[model samples]
Target chain A: MQQVQQQTTSDPILEIRGLTQNFGGLRAVSDFNVTLAGKQLTGLIGPNGAGKTTVFNLVSGFYQPSEGQILVDGVPTAGLKPHKVTALGVARTFQNIRLWNDMSVMDNIRVAQHYRLGYGFFHSAVRSKRYRQREEEIAREATELLEIFELKKYADEYPRNLPYGTQRKLEIARALSIHPKLLLLDEPAAGLNSSDIHELIRLIRWIHDRFDVTIWMIEHHMDVMMELCTHIKVIDFGQTIAEGTPDDIRNHPAVVTAYLGDDKI
Target chain B: MLRRYSVHLILATLGGLVVYLAYNEYLGLYYLSVLMFMGVNIILSSSLNLVNGYMGEFSCGHAGFMCVGAYVASVLGVWLFARDRVFGAPVLDPEYALYAFPVIILAGGIAAALAGLLVAFPSYKTRGDYLAIITIAANYIIISAIENMSAIGGSRGFMGMKGVINAMEDTIYLPWMPIWVFIFTIFSVWVIRRYVSSTFGKGVNAISQDEVAAEIMSVNTNKIKTITFMLSSGLAGIGGGLFAYILGYVNPGSFNILKSTEIMVMVYLGGMGSLSGSILAAILFTILLELLRPLQIIKWIVIPLVLIILMQFRPEGIMGNRELGQTFPRLKKFYRFK
Candidate 1:
């Protein structure tokens, strides 16, 4: 018994439509549409100038869409801030590796779980059993998150001391601390070494399969895109030019030109 | 996990020292006054530390809160001390005046906390240079408002704390204002040190690191600002309460922008997040000023030149955000018992 959705029947955990985003005079993203189904790893690929990160910003509410609709789990979130979007179960990492550099790695992860902590002064100051319990719970969770990202050895170390690749993994572990249903990773593999990128691809695939989360990642890595992504969306400047399996994205002439300078193919 | 017995051990040592000092009443008075100054500096640094160190917001108006606390406490002290004297008889006999000290200081703390609430609101709305102006404005407002109030010896200043001390002397045959000032100073430091290590305190540090991230993670930043401001002001008020008693006078002229600047200097010099740094700075700063006072006007030139030199080498100030124990970890067990 197949049911017809009033809109689309893709059963998307996240859906964006006609999202127009302007940065001062530049229309960074225009007529952007994306749908992410549950537990699917989707790639958002294009040339450097394409609106991939802009779309993440628009969806994350860092930049307000010039005009459009953003729906998370079928709920409209057109006018909201980043934290508000985060509260609605959409967590993101940054392209520039936005982290609390002075803080310990464990603190970075614990900070994300702040919303989950229910203890106030009465519970915290009085050392009530609940506070102690919650404290232990968060520590355990932070440890597990560190283990997942393979950053347990650097848990107590500050971000400034860690290697660049480890810092990026720490950033993802921090995002995972929020337990988001939809993860928006903006160029997670941007500056990773070859070995680290291999681990990242495996990790990203693992997270999708295990957590039942929909991952929408902006990346320029063809190998990562070809390896992990079930489907790919290709955009040029501000408009989507192609949407299909990875094979379709590879063959699309506009996406091809956007990357190779000219369609030699 | 820290124990009360550990606190008592440190207290007993300080208490033994205070007893030894009390044998010489004249020197005891000087020591008590210095101790009071040290306490005030602790409050100044610790509260400002909440903004400047733990919270990472630059504020320059500690003196304003001190003024607010001072006037409020002084007015209450005068009102209570005046008693039937308002009807021109002085309802509270001189003998009992010493006992009223705590009440007057509490009123000051509450009044200053209210004033702190005002500063906290504006702080949330602005940062950097804009916040600096707001603090400067607050300082001016407190000063002018105090000067305008003619009822309490406006510009010429007010006295009578000496009378209270005199009363206590008559009652107990005490040696120079008792040992409570030293006790309170130690207590203030201990409380702040303990609070800073707690969960609520970490939130302050988290805010200093990244505010947007803090809010997204549910740090309740606005509420923290309000509470932290109130707390710092309350501590400043405690300092004022002690200052009033120490000098045996209350004066608006003494609590000005310059005074606020002095507190700021102490906080920065001590190291923003370091409690022990402030405590040490307070002691050193007071001793430095006293030692330099013999140089009179020339002291200003030498001190500023030295400070500028110090700044070049240590931009984060003498302690540079590290606590005494952090800098000298070997002292941990002996220095802070708990």
Candidate 2:
């Protein structure tokens, strides 16, 4: 078994030290630790119900960790709410694609910037000059982001009407609109066809290089993880089983046993 | 920019025409009262729609906030501008009532907004039917609190607001209540439109659609919920203030569960999340209520039956969350809401 050691990065974007989570008496995640830095792309892989999402949920502040510390850019996120955590430059997408289905695509992108709206109820109610200027800037930025993702044509359409692949791309684009320092994507290729999967792989790689943001993804698809992730971490029953470069993880006996089970049986 | 504001200009002209008709006595007292009630209903439904439709919270105690507004505004107006048995002489000159009418209504709204915290705080943990139960209980609590206050006439009701209205008319020979109602109705709708169209306010929609996504995506769900409940209840308070002045009295029994249910019916009839839909539904519902006045007690039964049939055929309501412009695209050229 690989030892639980932190990555030696001088400037880490996300640092989790001995993070643990419990649902009643059941241990969902136990003593999880990881340090992601720079613009590195990492993969987290495990079987269903293996606490992969619980890790993302803990990092995103959806659930407070039972123990340990999470530092985003040197700030502890112990009691900060999810939106406050997002304000500190962390953004994420759901495994099931949780876009605001009723809102139009343009609004979906615009609303994600709610953290830095820089205005309030009175400004909006009175339509102050600052409110008007900020709104214009937000609209312009949203349009540009949509155009970059080639989603400008569907700007006025509701998200529910979009095809499955387009919806996934829109969700990723929405997360990036917040200008996150770290983007956590939970299975971007889960529901996409083979062609869409290829497009998504290219899209994610381009986003990593273009946006200068660290990416941490969770996926069950082996080919996508092998092709995209430079480093891989495998967990089973909420315990870290192996951690290394993707090639090393591929050859690790612990990971093989965790995924395929005992051959002697 | 000019094209964007053209709609406001057109509405202003329409408002001026109504005031002119009222001044010339072209519309009688009966018609004028109907028009004023329309304005009041418009404020009530649109405000409730902010919470129920846009924010997707089932708030059944809207009249509780309205009751708070009505009592606060009535007592303040009587104490400040009129002679009453409860409070000897007027604090300010009766003539100031004309100038301070808007202030009185706004004061009512602010008081109601503070009362809205009763529900907003609980909403942090509970939602859906649980929140609905809290709101319903809050409605009872507010009504019971006012009903037990013997100083304000309690169950018997309170009056002397007519003196305040008379003081205002004595200052100017205009139909002051109609004018104020029209102005505040338009103001409330304008504020709501501006709020919902802005990115900050779209957080309400985000919360309604998927609160988890909203919270994780940087929308402060709790703060948004608080602001929405306050704004919604505050506007309902304004509506209640107007209703009290129009009728020249305040009573706890008037702002009861039945009244709250009426406002909800108007919201559902209009379609949730559409300001234009709320306004249209309010106007139609008001006229329907007035027309069916002859039915008296039977009207309640008939109205619910109509709503039931409406639900069976068009469950999403008349506009189905689309604005007037979206329902009829030709209206877009004249003015775009966003």
Candidate 3:
């Protein structure tokens, strides 16, 4: 962990210390610890039921931890709601592509800026000068975002109407609209075919290079993990089994047992 | 800019025409009252649509907030502008009632909005059917609370809002109730439209579609839910205030579960999340109610049957989720709803 911290010069964006979460008697995640800094791409991987998604949920403030602390930019996010946590410069995508299906694609991007809309209900209802300027700004920026992501053609279309791969792309675009310092991608390649997976890899790499965001992604695809992640952490049954470079993780005995079981079996 | 406000211009002209006809006695009292009720229904349906359609919360107790508004506005109007049996002499001159009526109605709306917190607070942890039951209970609690207050006439009902209208009429010799109803109806719809179009307001839509995703995406689900419920209930309160003055009386029995169900029917009939559809449904539903008045008790049975048939044929309602402009593209040239 200290060696990982030494690799990056900037201060840590996400610092988790002894995080633990229990769903009744079942321990979903326990004693998880990681310190991510700068703009490095990190990956979390494990077999099914390895508490991978649970860790993402904990970091994103969706689930309160049983014990431990999470800090975003060194500000404690222990009791903050998800939106408040997001306001501290964190954004995430779901494993299941949880875009607002009924809303138009443009709205999906626009609504992510809800935390910084800069106006209140009265401003909106009365359409004050401030409201007009803010709304116009939001619209212009949302348009620009869609253009950059090459999704402007589907601006007026609903998310459910978009193709599955395009929907995933749109979800990532929506997440990026928040301008988060730390971006959490949970299973971005979950349902994509080979070509879309290739496209996703390129998109993720481009986004990491272009957006200046520190990305932490969870993926089952070993190639995606190996290709994109500078560092990989493996967990099984809520326990951290391996942590190192992708090459080290690919050959680590504990990781292999966690994924493929032991040779004796 | 002219095209942007063309819809407002047309609505204003229609409102002015109605006021002119009513003031001249060219429109009879029956028609005037029917029009006033239509306005009230418009306020009710569109406001309820904000919660039920836009926010996607099953709030079946909308009338409870309306009842709170009706009583508050009625009592305030009487206490300030007219002599009341419970409150004795008027605090202000009756002559001022004409200008102060809107303030009284808005006060009622504010009160109803505060009352909406009853449901809004519980909504953070509960949703769907569980929230529905809480809202239904809240409706009962509100009605029962008023029924137990003997100072306000309790179950026997409350009166004196008629005197406020009469005072306004004496000052200006105008159709005060109809004009006020029309103004408030338009006002509520405009407020809802502006709210739902703003980025801040789109949080309501985000919550309805997927709340977890909404919260994680930086949409403050709780704040948005609170605002939506309050706005929805506050508008309904305005409708209730107008209804009280229109009938010159208010009874707790009038704002019961049946009344709430009527508003819900209007919301679903117009289509969820469509402002134009809600307005259209409110107008059509009000007219249908009046037309079926000859059936008296049978009207209830007929209304539900119609709703059943509507659900069977088009469960998404007349507009589904699209606005009138989206459905009829030609309307886009005449008006921009956003």
Candidate 4:
């Protein structure tokens, strides 16, 4: 670490209060509230269909909560669209990798910087001096990101050609390229083998320490959650049941009943 | 720094040389007509390519916008330049007609772009098959609505555009229609090429691949769709204006669903998301239509069969969404028309 003062360090970057979501008649998430301090590494773990992903969708502005509010960096974002939330410095990766399959890996990373690019369509078409300078910067940034993920060698290849683990890594690299203040990883370790899970845990830890951002990940694997996340929030039946440090969450009664059994926890 | 404009300089010079040759009568009338139609097809296919190919929207009503453009451009062209049929001699002097031609075409483009917004707004709520149906219905609605308007000739169609061309010729002794068509075609292709190679264009590809992810990535999917549709429809309008000039008449029947399908075939055959492919497909398709003219009704059957074979063998189309610059690295030095 360079002993740099991160922008997200002092204040709570995300504050959710009474956030509730309903799909048709069924409540998918109800009265969900949590607060993440800047630079906190948090985990959201639940059993299958525990509405873990729903919370991610709500915070990222994919769904308007049937009720309640979400504030990011002190600004309310209840009815904002996903792109607007992203512009507010919240970036997320889907449970299933959603990389642009036809684009080259390098282009995938560059696409996330779509808003930050100051030039308009006319400048790009004419390839003006500002366009050239900005484009060079985008390329350099994308290359640097790829280098961090060990994907520099595969920059020209399409995402579909990458192996499973590498594809997952590429998605993370893409989300990071947005320079988000809050990073949400929805089941980041889903479908990975044990060795790959170990690699991912290491990567997530490195990201938490290296990047000047807060992280909240949804994981089904308790081992990964316990090892990587300093704070943990547990949800079941579309409601938050327990939240504390990983050790306290491991010993919580409601969490044990909802997800991890007494024996497993 | 100025070396980047060499490709544009070369293209401009080539266009001028062709116009010069046409003026000198070096090319026969038949060849001149063929070249003009090629230019028109290039505009149609390339503009449609923006929506159908790169944007990955199933827009079956492209000709609806074209119809709007054609009527708007033709009616204005005749109203200003050919007043003999309506009231008396031309209200606007023939001397000004040549200068006013591009403005008239641009007006047509603006009208068509407005019409495009009508369709684009519905796209925010619907997508894929539902949006396709909306566009198809839009095509029918435009044609039927125009056919019902007897003031502009109704189903019988509208004429008098030829008089505007004649007015221009009477003012200046030069082949103006071909020159203007060639220039507009090049301009349309140039603008679209510039658009697709830009960051905005890449947002289009991202939407096509995965829309939700693109939205989450801060790519305003709705804004991009609206802009792309408007741009595509506007260029189609310009092509339609050129088309009305070439035919010297505008008929509601000329821009039916079949016309839209024809453009769609060119788009798919050329390869989705490739500007060079659009140009190549437009040329080859125009030639194919001419070659098949002898077969008449059988040509329709044969054309669909050819498309079927193409889809079966090369489903991604001729260029497979890769631009010419990507296919041939050596061409990269010539221009970055990626």
Candidate 5:
């Protein structure tokens, strides 16, 4: 709850400078950069295999960049593991919606708060007051988060049993369980129906307004991005081609060419 | 809060009853040995369950840790507390053995845990079949190392712990072996049950489910693996200590690949991710082992054949990741999430 508490600051919540990732001989993400301010819902759009997911991987600490630095709240995360990066107030959902599918939906969310737990193993073994207090708090907070996503009904069910859209929403809810300052969504709307997309857009906007977190999403759906994102960045072949407001990105020559396969625009 | 305290109270009373029965000779020697075997299997299977079941990693070399614990405890028992045929007189008088017994067992656990690090660190870089190989190698290495240690009687193996256990008996008039075995068995299950139910323990489940997602969610997968392995191996060490005391002798041959396989069979039979299942399966497995003693070498063949048939019919094992409470509605009231 302390992490979700709003702190007004002029500083950007995330700043990636000269980030580049090379997988063997191929340059997957070349010199990618972005500065995300707190509470901003930004979009990153590109064609398939445009290194968008690779960029997400690098920023999220799934892969160490061959070149560049990622600063979360102005701290370097070059050598840190993904979990350590997450502990520094960054959380992410996968492109394929990776939830702890065997665990109940409520457990999926509660498990994300592993680091936030203050009690030691001995304390829990003895069922000390501190363990009971912390556990009760986690259960309460997880249930509240599930309710926000309209997932209270499925709390006892495993994530694998949930509908696809609900699973996606649950993944987002799990990410939010970290009470992170920054959230990275990789292809959030990749396989959703249009109605689900609309609901997702509404949910994203609601989250941007309600939670004190910066949101950077990789979305293939242009309508969702145009409808929800305040700023948009376009990439092609691992290179950033344009960055500006959604309208500006939509009109940029390189951006239109990258998506439509044309330079005459 | 009252329910929690009552649970502990009930457990304590039950434990007291079992210890009392064994100490007073109300139970025959053969039955007592069988009960003690059940306790050791409970410790072994449940500890292995922490890694292979709850953590969702395959480790087949668990007996190696048991060997380490058994040897360390045996040596320390002779050197510090008791006289022996091979090792001569104790460095200290037998009067101190009642206190020294636990310290020796704990030392064994610590040593086994240190040995566990060898496998745990390598596990970070590998998984599945490769991890299995690593664990197998670790098992062989521990056995071979012990066999080669001439100072500890090498391949002839060592015998001396009977003197130490007897010293403890002389110090306190109670049934030392059964009582200690009972206490350690409860401690093992309690530690594991408490672990898998806690928030940090949930990280182990998360790693088992999806390592990448768990990492992005701030579950330290590497650290969790290390801790789980150490805890698992440490408990196995305690089981080994109890085993050495019960047998009054130990050999590298006793803690071999076959021993590890038996523990693995118990884990799968119990079902993965269910602590109660592990405990139940261990009891049944120990009983089966006892019943099969007349079968000689044929017991191994029959055991695996039964396991194969069981896999065909119910591949998830008896509990199949569901606890006894999940299957029986009447038992639900007694179920705590841990």
Candidate 6:
């Protein structure tokens, strides 16, 4: 927990301390802590029911922290609504793909860019000159984001018609439109092929570099977890068992046991 | 682009055509008043559509807000017409009557917006079935509260504006309230359609699709909900205002749960999120209600039967949540050539 504090002060984008989430009688996540540095990818990996998603829920304001401190950019975030938290530059994607399926793909991205693209009442309501300019800017930005995700071809179509891989990328693209300081991806590569995984890694790296956004990824794919995350945190039964670089996490005795069940790493 | 401008102009021209057609063919006093009701219903349905269809929240208290608008508008009309006489003379000088109606209607919209703010506040914490219940409760509460207000005549109802209507008729031999209805109906439809297509309405759709995802995307769901709710309720208020003028009386019993259900039917029948769908449905609903008039009380049976058929064959309703332009893009394209 103290180390979580130190991380917040020294080279940290997000710091979680003494985090605990209990589902009725069950302790889904208890006394867990993780630190994500700026502009780097951190992987959160564990077996089923290891409370990986629950931790993300706590940090993202989907679920209030049961007993923990979440500091984003050194500001303690307690009791802030999800949108307020998002405005503070922390954004996330769900494990289940959640897109506005009925709306145009362009609309999905533009809505995300809405608060950022500011204008006045006459502009928006009466189609004032400023509002028109804002709309064009929003459209351009949305189109640009769509193009990057390789989804420009389907810009006019709804998300429901999009292929699974493209949908995932579009989700990421929508998140980036907010210009967040930290991005939390619940499971980017969950149901993707090796080819898709390759594309996702490149995209993630590209986002990290181009957008200067820190990423905290929760993924079951070992290869993705091992390859992308600059640092790794391993959780088991709601406790942090091992925490280090990918190689350190891979070699940690408890992590090896957690993965291989007493078999050598 | 200039092409978009031309497209807008063409749309306006078509709207003009619809108004001309309605006037040329359907302008008797009774039918004219019905046209006013139709316009009001269009505003109500489209506004409710924003919350129920576009924002995808189940709001069942539109009539309650409409009652608020009606009472406020009527009260203001009475007060202003009194000319410092306070509670006297519900109608002022004859020629100025048109001015009063629009003022009352606008006041009604603003008052309804306030009521919407109240309903919207609680919705921030809940959604789906629970919110629906709150809205329904709000509807009942508004009706009951208004019914309890003795100053407003309570359940007995109130009247004042007939003198204004009489004055207009005394001056102009062939005064038509339907003309006002047709124009305002056009105004209401055009405003809602354009609003929904703009960037702001994109937020409404975001709330419907995925609220959490929307917030994370930097879309302010709370602001959108609040604004959308107010706008939707305000439109319902305007509908009620027009309704009051059309009926020449105001009563709590008039805008009951059945009225809210009526608007809901129109919205769903038109397609949940479709603006043009609501208009089409409102018109069809009015006509169907009239056609079933011969059946008398049996019309209620036919209404549900049509709803059942709608659900079975095309649950999306007549327009399936699509606008006239969206449903038939070719219609829009054809007009655009001009």
DockQ of each: 0.32, 0.86, 0.88, 0.66, 0.72, 0.60
- Residue-level lDDT of model 6, residues B1-338, one tens digit each, is 55557756765685566556554655466665665677788888888998999988999889999999888877776655533233765445646666666766788989898989878998888999999999999999899999999887889886665655565555664344555565567667766666777787678788898887777676677888888898889878888877776787899998899889888888888899887788888888888777788999887788888888989999988887676777688777544321
TM-score of model number 6, chain B: 0.88
What local lDDT does model 2 show for residue A251? 90
Task: Name the regions of candidate 2 deviating beyond 4 angstroms.
Answer: A1-9, B1-6, B336-338
- Candidate 6 lDDT at B273 equals 85
* Residue-wise C-alpha lDDT for candidate 3, range A143-258, written one tens digit per residue: 99999999999999999998999999999999999999999999999999999999999999999989989999999999999999999999999989999999999999998887
lDDT of each candidate versus the true structure: 0.74, 0.93, 0.93, 0.89, 0.89, 0.80
Q: Candidate 6 docking: what grade? A: medium
Residue-by-residue lDDT tens digits, candidate 2, A168-187: 99999999999999999998
| Winner on lDDT (2 vs 5) | 2
Off by over 4 Å in 3: A1-9
lDDT tens per residue, model 2, B1-338: 76799978887897888889999999898999999999999999999999999999999999999999999999999999999999979999998999999999999999999999999999999999999999999999999999999999998899999999999989998889888998999889989998999999999999999999999999999999999999999999999999999999888999899999999999999999988889999999999999999999999999999899989999888888999988899977778554
In model 3, which residue pairs have backbone atoms overlapping below 3 Å? Answer: none
lDDT of 5 by residue, B1-338 (tens): 65446567777897888788987889888898899989999999999999999888899999999999999988988888877666777899899999878888989988999999979999887988899899999999999999999888898888888888788889888878888888889888989988888887888999988888888888888888998999999999989988988998889999999999999999999898888889999999999988999999999999999899989998888999987778886765654544
Model 5's CAPRI class is: medium
Interface Cα RMSD of candidate 6: 1.8
Quote model 1's TM-score: 0.86
Where does candidate 4 stray beyond 4 Å?
A1-9, A126-129, A260-265, B1-6, B333-338
Between candidates 4 and 6, the one scoring higher on lDDT is 4
Task: Rate residue A201 of model 4 by lDDT.
Answer: 93
Best-fitting candidate, scored by DockQ = 3
TM-score of each: 0.86, 0.97, 0.97, 0.94, 0.95, 0.90
Query: After superposition, which runs of candidate 1 have C-alpha atoms over 4 Å from their true positions?
Result: A1-12, A23-25, A64-66, A73-81, A121-130, A260-265, B1-7, B23-26, B81-104, B158-191, B216-218, B333-338
